[model samples]
Target: MKDLFHKSLSRRSFLRYIAATMATTAVDWFKIEAMASTVEPKSDYPVVVIGAGIGGLVAATYLAKNGFPVTVIEQHDVPGGYVTSFERGEFKFDVAPHYTLGLSPFLEYLGIQEKVELVKPPEFFRVITPEHDLILPQEDPRGIIRVLSEKFPHEEQGIKSFMSLLNGLLQEWVKPFDMKTISSTHPIMWNLSKLNTAQVFDQHFKDPRLKAVLCIFGSGFGLPPSRLPALVFSPGTAASIYVGREYVKPCGQGFSNALMQAIENNRGRVILKTEVESILAKDGTVTGVRTTNGKTYTAKAVISNASAPATFEKMLSPGHVPDSYMAKLRTYRPSHSYFLVWLGLNKELRGKFKGFQNVVIPEHYDPEDDDKATSACNASKTRFQVYIYDALYSGYSKPGKSTVKILMQCGYRPWKHFEADYFAGKKEAYRKEKDRIAQILIERAESKVIPGLKSMIEVMDAATPLTHRRYTKNPEGAVLGYEHSMDNYWIYRNKNRTPIKGLYLASAWGSPGGGVNPVVRGGQSAFTDLMLDWAKIK
Candidate 1:
């Protein structure tokens, strides 16, 4: 089943979108207190974690398993942040696509790997455009590169150089992925940083079209290649070159389940539906947190998997925080959010499409076009990047049913497009937009594949920026942390350590930015910070 995710990653294959399909049973993480043993451990334990999302959970698991008791608190009924799923009658929607999944060394360091379910997809990304398309097999990125070179023969040189660079960066390293640690110790990274992603592309990629294709990898961070540091792309591309740069995990059953299991298996405590509204801070050091409900739990150290802005803005007293840190949070740009079309269909799409992922780039579309599109959406009119999930995930496909999910990437800015008069709540607005955009998207995709998919309506649903905000607590509904702007990406990418003493930031909001793989890597880095040096008292 996991191999399906790897295989579907090849952009040229239509078989990736095939899915087995679902229903409306709500998973209550709270009631499953059985998962939480009768023994309430971690009393007076060293660390207290805020938000049981991926980063927080990983950090908690590592700390607890290493003999330090840890407590993980969450605002939601369930954990996993965006990496969770919900069922509506026969349809199940994975709110976000998480691919290239990996559990960092931190998992092994804590020795809880067996408690979690982890699998590497056979391959990760499948690239598609009207002009050229391909099925990039895992460990065979050259196949996709050939397709790109074949598409634009005049740009073969640029294409080859681009793929080579990306492949080298994403390769699995014997060393853990860490932006801060590696920059100081790894000479390879030091040399790579000489040229930022933009400078590298300008220096080698003469073909603008090829540049657009190669740089799309930057999308892993909600960034464009031109703006990213070459160092960021280096490690990022290494993984993509091997498996097409995308991987998928079940947010509901797979990801969240693994997180909770790991936490409990390590003797840690997880409490959900409890939002930590304010941190109980003293002078300049640490303490515990007070949930909005007024319950307070004390601990020696606090780690946050919440977004950098939320932790600083809402949790800690603004006065205790550094002015510099506050300014960084206040001004930090959140990532571009998304709009989704989730569908439950009655037919098998395996034969209809060869790839699990299909990407459509309009003729001569400029990579910068993404910037303009997101900006326009910030104001009113917004364009979209179409993601068709029809071929690879058989898990979503029931015995006789299939699922079709499409993604329309829009900026969080345009969420205000709904007039204040018609601002209807999240659920209401989502229902209205589902019909309107679903029709348009059906027309667009049907013309490309299903011939008449516009009529194949069994079930349909939509999610707007507001939905992302409500579910993920992403401010302004930004899907992937802060938006990646040229001026801010390098500096704005937060560090794992925060100014508030005894606290650290994990997850995509910090270094390594967003995407499941990098965040996993970020978890490993965060653990090293806690155990290796930071805690080794002289």
Candidate 2:
């Protein structure tokens, strides 16, 4: 799970890499232990955020902007948690190829609109299926309808109805969400909340292939339609697709740097490489946090951007969390992880590539089968997104080369067994397994879209679920955090508030769920809740 080249990059090396990023604008922006009897006295900050993920950074930035003393602590040397980038040779690969929305409004609100660049990707992305190859424009519902209707003329009315419904849902459902007026009682959303994506699709269309195409966007949530909550799928996946802008950073470093800049400019402290040992609390209220390096930080309020399960099970002691809350956390399941292949090619693929973001779904991909196979790491029927950054933007690679990132949803089950003692002969097997899977995935990509893709590779590195766990320490490497299922969509999505007062959750796992935009929104919600609580203080 370490770097592809190094056994363990030294602290100096980490500093060098991170320093380069920081110097350039990589805004280098987790969990718990026991309460200590004696510790040095420390001045209390108004807010202390655990984990420097996008959510944490956003919350910290807001608090600092309002003139509250805030500090963010991260386990990693860099900031941005899932929004990070890693360098290998001349190429820098984004940890996650985030398609962002709400960046403009967020930055504009912070009075830093011009400070960050929200680069729109090439207007279109292609979906390759057995029966059809569809090139859909970004945020264009009619384009999608035209394509689908043309592909399935017999289902023209169905396609039109589906697309129209999605568009209408966008104007009706998503606006309230953006305005923060959405509630569990909202009639339309409440009804939508009860339906799974598959159920909604069934009512609108019958063609299996067409349904698959519609469900592809929901895959961004790391689940197939059948299991995906309609509320999550409709607004963001289906409807929001027409309204939401799609973007890719030349690299996320600059974006992260902008966030950190916003925070520091507001007088917030972003502490790196400082792992939070525990969330300090007394009498059901948060005291602060203690770090691994024997340093204790005192704060009136704390927000955790780490995984939800880890925050409760590992970060807090038994009494600090209530039995009911613990029971709810226990019921939550982490979402699917990913198996990624980062390739630095020897040649530019722009001329040969058709789209900035490409998806390859098997000819007769069944959503149910896709859900099963991918979660089990079966590449045979796996659906994946091929993000050719070089095609989208030029500065990401050397003059003649390009960077290709291949992502497939995979579960941690297959990779977890490899964590046995290395000296006991498990290491080589793990390495070979990673290589084997990477080869299969590469072959899949080559066979489907790019012929001779293996020959073009100059540098290739792969990441398993284990790598994700090792880096972010997310439980089971769930990249998007806890799954957003119908069960949790309305009543159970963990909110910013916890049983322990003044300790709030602010990560992908929190309410509003995953994706960079949602996490940022979650952070804003956490900050809003904190402000409300603060106002209530007599």
Candidate 3:
């Protein structure tokens, strides 16, 4: 039924249809008008969101739905920030990981799940090492245990204990906390916040291979076990992968487009290619923003979806932010970025690969060593994960073709010089370095796991840290925002509220860390803060 309806109408059209339908039927116009009359002032703009990333878009949509006049300013020509897609000939590939978990609640909160389609991949992922190849199942701890036990019969009890911990931690995180009483000494999350990922794993499992498998979970968040906070990494990542039905769209474009449509349907404005030069404020209260295009927009409040450093250091004057806050932002450690290689194949490779996500892990995989090694670009030292969209959803590629993405761990410092060199008449060297790295990665994949992968590639493009920085404007190309370490969890994480009144942050830099779903939730949290302020207004 959904396929037929979607076939007849586009996602944007369907969103608009629902918006019109709700306006006429579902919503009580009288109550809305009464609320507006009682609370809303005669202001041209009440909220201005900077950066049209998922977080900013979600916030804008929610505020606009509640009758607040909102405008979103994005420097990119498109929305979604890192959660976006691109097309090359017959292929479409997602820049970020294609699979996402914990969507139902978020979609339900937005009341748009019915308007969007999500494709669930068959399993979690396939982990390939030199000695073992294991296919991990999703949402089934027992199944995972059974499979791992078959590989190492003696460690069955260890596997069971680890699985129990994963599930237990997940439950602990989902428990609601009382905001009024929540503090550093809060019983609910204090111990978890103090624990690191490696410490918990070492205490539970003795098998090195088992520990390696678990460490990969932290890699997904761009952290190593030693540095990753147990509370944030264990429960958050487990909830995402093992506690729910996992799903992904054909690509991220539809999801991004749908959010944009939802915002417009709610009467919010999204201005693309307009860079916000500085956040306007007076007496420590947000007034509006000035854009690079020489236009000033006024609003009662502001939400920043850009990185914390970008928001505080670059977008505002030094006087507007406190020295303590500036020092904190400077000292806060950012997470590792990624190097991606996108491929368009002639035909579906799933018959041989047989998995949606295939990871090529080194036999001597050490999370701490790999995490340190990513500080520089080296193809041989890097681990790679390959995503075959055609394995589950064929729409990402043409009729018989497939779309594959290879993501490698990388740091921003190695490619930092490329940008400077480009302007200094050394464009050839920059291009050559990127091409050389791409070729090396391709060869490495072909030799290690997927043979004939080079011949299958019809279109290819590579993105370094510099490429990500160029497009997303993330300082230092830090894709996952602040590092999810012991020091940056719960009370230590950046809060939505700033010292400046009417200013808030809704990005990966804030609490709960990065990823499409978490950032979307971050946006929702920011919206709640905005609503509280609105409730207190005259």
Per-model TM-score, in order, reads 0.81, 0.88, 0.89
Q: Write the per-residue lDDT of candidate 3 for residues 140-179, one digit (tens) a residue.
A: 5567777888887877777666666665544344334555
Off by over 4 Å in 3: 1-38, 42-45, 178-190, 423-426
Using lDDT as the measure, which candidate wins? 2
lDDT of 1 at 58: 67
> All models: lDDT?
0.61, 0.75, 0.74
- lDDT for 513 in candidate 3 is 67
Q: When superposed on Cα atoms, how far off is each prediction in RMSD?
A: 8.7, 10.7, 7.3
lDDT of 1 by residue, 1-538 (tens): 0121233244332111111000001222222222222323435446778887777776776666555677888888878877777787776777777765233333444454454444443334455555556455655656666676677888777766666555333222323345667665555555566666767778666767666666555655555565566766765565455534333433344656676777787777899888888777788767888888998878667888888878887788768898977776667678777777777777766556655555545555566766666554421222233343435555656655566666666766555666343345534664665467657766666765456565665777777777677766767777667554444444446777777767787777876567665566456456555543332431
Residue range 218-323, candidate 2, lDDT tens digits: 7788778888888788766542344345454556766677778889998899999889988888999988888888898888999999888878888787788888
The CA lDDT at 63 in model 2 is: 79
The candidate, 1 or 3, that scores higher on TM-score is 3
lDDT of 1: 0.61
